[model samples]
Target chain A: MHSFFGKQLPVAVAFFSGVLMIITFFSGDQTVADFSQEQLVWVTIVGGFSLLLGVASITRVSLSDVRKRRKGWPYKAVLLIFLVASSLGAIIEGTERGTLYDWLFQNMNAPMMSTMFSLLAFYIASAAYRAFRARTVEATILLITATIVMLGRVPLGELIYGKLPEITDWIMNYPNLSVQRGIIIGAALGAASMSLRIILGIERTYLGRQ
Target chain B: MNHDIVLFLEMTLAGFLTLCIFSFLYKDNPFYRLAEHIFAGLSAGYYVGLIWHSVIMQQLWVPITQNGQYSLILPGLLGVLMFTRLVDRLSFLSRVSIAFVVGNTAGISIIQQLHGFVLPQLGDTMSRFGQEFWGPLIILIGVVSTLIYFYFSKEHKGALGITAKVGTVFIMVSFGAHFGYTVMGRVSLLIGRVQFLFVDWVHSFNKIIN
Candidate 1:
């Protein structure tokens, strides 16, 4: 009974919902389209609650660490405290305009994310220096192309050479565009095939063990 | 209680956090760790509140309470079932929720992948042939050869080997261009932070001083 509901039922549900969505896309029926749209909303609602799973997992781990007095228990405690505080603030104040939630997000969250992401700049430069060595024919081409593109993208490139931008544009438009299109076509085909497989129940990986 | 004072405080806090995060470039330290953890916790909490307010309150709560739509309870139940994964015996119940997501995404993606990606790319590639003489010709060749290179069933030998080599060159050039573009993006982000520090914050402080 457990297996029937847990495993088989879900598979059936997926097949039906997926087929319905496909029908909604291709069929001209207004009622079907409306129902499918409603189903999409349901999916979003389910996905929204799914976010709590992550919070629950993180909270559990943090609590366990605090209880065991792990190496970074203090940090874990800080994380839990902030998590609780921020969640409470947002929930209590409401996430509407001119709220504490918005203020925290704008001031703290956005800056931290952008700063963390920006740190990749230093790392990427270091990586390029190490990896873009002109050791072979291919490596040499890659190194030159990368240098040209990087230079063209920045204001410093124009200062160094006026034609650098034009050359960069040509490379990006012709060769880069061609290769990208090819990659995109191939990926789309692959994705379509994979989607088909999943819909048809050929892909059972999502079900996880039986 | 001047608005400028609050704005200044917010800017200063953001700058401080940004600098703390950037300190990771030197070495791992308590300040960096604290900032990183706080960012993680706060973002997680923010997402929780955002999703609740946006998806649950709007889609589930509002409709059920205000509009009196009871059908939403089905998806709501399924969403609740996902939490059962935390339990040892009841974990299988989560599969139902996963199936719904997987199926719906797979179904919708079929038409979307075809319309959004595959068809447009195919049309674009084909249309390029009519636009210019050599440029489109070269693109068509690159696209075909690249696809052939990825076709692993047949062993690359003779003409296929040469074509595959050309395909490899295109792939390498594409990768190099992508890496350069990514580096540029990251660098721009870094530049934004620098600009904020040197320009915006400095001007604000200057105004306060005056």
Candidate 2:
């Protein structure tokens, strides 16, 4: 019974939904197509719940850390406080302008998040310093290309060299476009094949096994 | 009068939070840790409220009540079933939700991947082979060579070896261009933060003092 409910049932569900979606796409009937579109919206609604699952996981982990008095228990405690407070504030206020949720989101969340990403610039420079080795032919090409493109992109590069922008455009439009197309083609093929596998139950990793 | 005071406080808090994040550049200390925790907690909480309003109220509740679309109830129930994972005995029920979402994505993606990415990319690459012959020829060479590089079924020897090596150069150049663009984007974000700090924060501070 457990095996049927836990694993087999889910696999069957996947097969049913997968087949239904494909049929709807190819079906000339308007009703089936409409149902498929509605089902897609259902999928989206279901997906949102998955994010709530993430919140549950975080809360559980943070609660455990605080309960156990872990190394950063004080921070965990602070996290819990903010989590509860922000949630209540937002739920009550509805995220509208002049609401506590909106103010906190704009003032606190936006600033902290943007600053965090901006800090990545400094680290990326350090990373580039370590990674930009030109020992091989490919490495030399990469280093030169990166340097040109980077220099060509900025206003400072235009001040330094008149042709940088034009050269940058050529590289981006030609070789970059070609490689990007190849990558897109490859990825699309891979995705289609993987989807087929999952539909056929050949891939069961999502079911908690290899 | 009170609104002005709140605005001042908001700007001051945002500036202080921005500094807290930047403090990580020097070293990971208490300030950075505090900011990180606060950000994570609030973001998670914000998601809960966002979903409660956007998905539950808007998608499920309003649709059912106002539009009399009772079909949404099934997906809503499926979403609620996702919470069953919290219980040991009924955890298997959550897989039903996962299966539906995954299956839906797989089916849609199979068609999307083929129609949106694969066919369009192939068409674009193939169609560009007129008028500007050399440019398109270079693209073709880059694409074919790059694809050959990824084809690991056959051992690289002689002609294949040379083509694969050429592929590596194209790949490297493309990668370098991508990295440069990414860095530029991060730098732009960095500039935004710096402008906020220098202009907005400083002006606000100056106003407060005056």
Candidate 3:
């Protein structure tokens, strides 16, 4: 009963819902399509509910740390406070065109996020200078391809060598695509295996117990 | 002068950011710390705003308002359940949310992966040999051999050993390609900033033209 209700229930619903959605994609039946849409909505609802766990967990941990007065607990508290306040504000006051939520979003959020994203430039540069080294045969091929692609992508490539585009495209379309596909397929199979294990109750680590 | 003022401002900010980045080379200092924190705050604010507008508003509010309250009940309930993590004793209630999210996301991702990742990738791989008969054949051999070399189930020796060695060549090329592309991207960004400083703000070219 515990397995059925506690663990299996959600998985069962998801599996069935997934099948239904797939069917709806292929089917012409309006009623069936409608049913699938509703099921998807239910799926979304379930997803949203699940996301709350993250927020709640964060809040719980941060609050606990705040109460205990642990080192660097203040940052956690600030984050928790920000999360809760923003969530609440958005939920209650949010509207389509403009709202206080929109103001908070534009004024407070966009600039900060863009600033953080900008850091990638500096980090990538430093890492490149420090870590980039060709130690083998494979590195040479990569170096050649990278140089060609870089030259080919912009107007500068044409200025440097008119044939760069043709060569770059050939490389990208042929070997690069093949290698990328192989990696992607391997990755998908791994993910599917992992998901299957979870659904079948073979994997229980997420249950938060050994 | 108006343009120069804006140019000066941009150059100043760019210079400051560059310095903050450089400071990391020496040691973690107050300047780097301040810049990092400010960036952190700004980015967090941006993300929070984005979530409010994009996810919360579009997914929740719009549906409830347009479709009517009854239609949104299930999703609303599920979303509320996400907050269950806040309660220490009842925190396990958050699992319901997790189950819903993980199940549906996995389900959706699997289907999307088949269409988006698998089909196109497969098509590309299959078409490669046709485009460059010998080139792709050699690359394919190299890729497969390298993968076999990495495989640990059995020993690679004799003729198989040579194939594995050749495979290493392909792998090195791939990494080199990746590195070169990354460097090119960073260089472009730096160039973009320089262009902005020179053309957009300073109007140095205007003086030359006059």
Candidates 1 onward: DockQ, in order = 0.78, 0.79, 0.28
**lDDT of candidate 2 over B126-155, digit per residue (tens):** 897666798988898888888888888999
- A1-210 per-residue lDDT for model 3 (tens digits): 545544666556545654565567678999988887776776665564454444445556767888999976656556655565555666677633466545444434443344444455677778756765566556556667777887887788999999988877776655665455456766766676666565555665564531
| lDDT by residue (tens digit), candidate 1, A69-125 | 999999998888888778888878898768877887888889999999999999988
In terms of docking quality, how is candidate 2 classified? medium
Q: How does each model score on TM-score? A: 0.96, 0.96, 0.72
Tens digits of per-residue lDDT for model 3, B92-200: 5445555655555555566666767767655655677766687667556654665565666767788777766765665555555565577666666656545544664
lDDT string, candidate 2, A120-195, tens digits: 8998999988877888888888889989999999989999999999999999988888788788888899999999
Model 3 ranges with Cα > 4 A deviation: A1-6, A19-31, A45-131, A143-166, B1-27, B31-35, B38-58, B61-66, B69-71, B127-132, B135-152, B158-162, B189-210
Instruction: Give the lowest summed-lDDT range of ten residues in model 2 chain A.
Output: A201-210
Q: How accurate locally, in lDDT, is each candidate? A: 0.86, 0.88, 0.59
lDDT of 1 at B51: 77
Q: Sort by TM-score, best first.
A: 1, 2, 3
Clashes of 2: 0
Model 3 / residue B3 / CA error / Å: 14
Off by over 4 Å in 1: none
For the predicted complex of model 1, DockQ is: 0.78
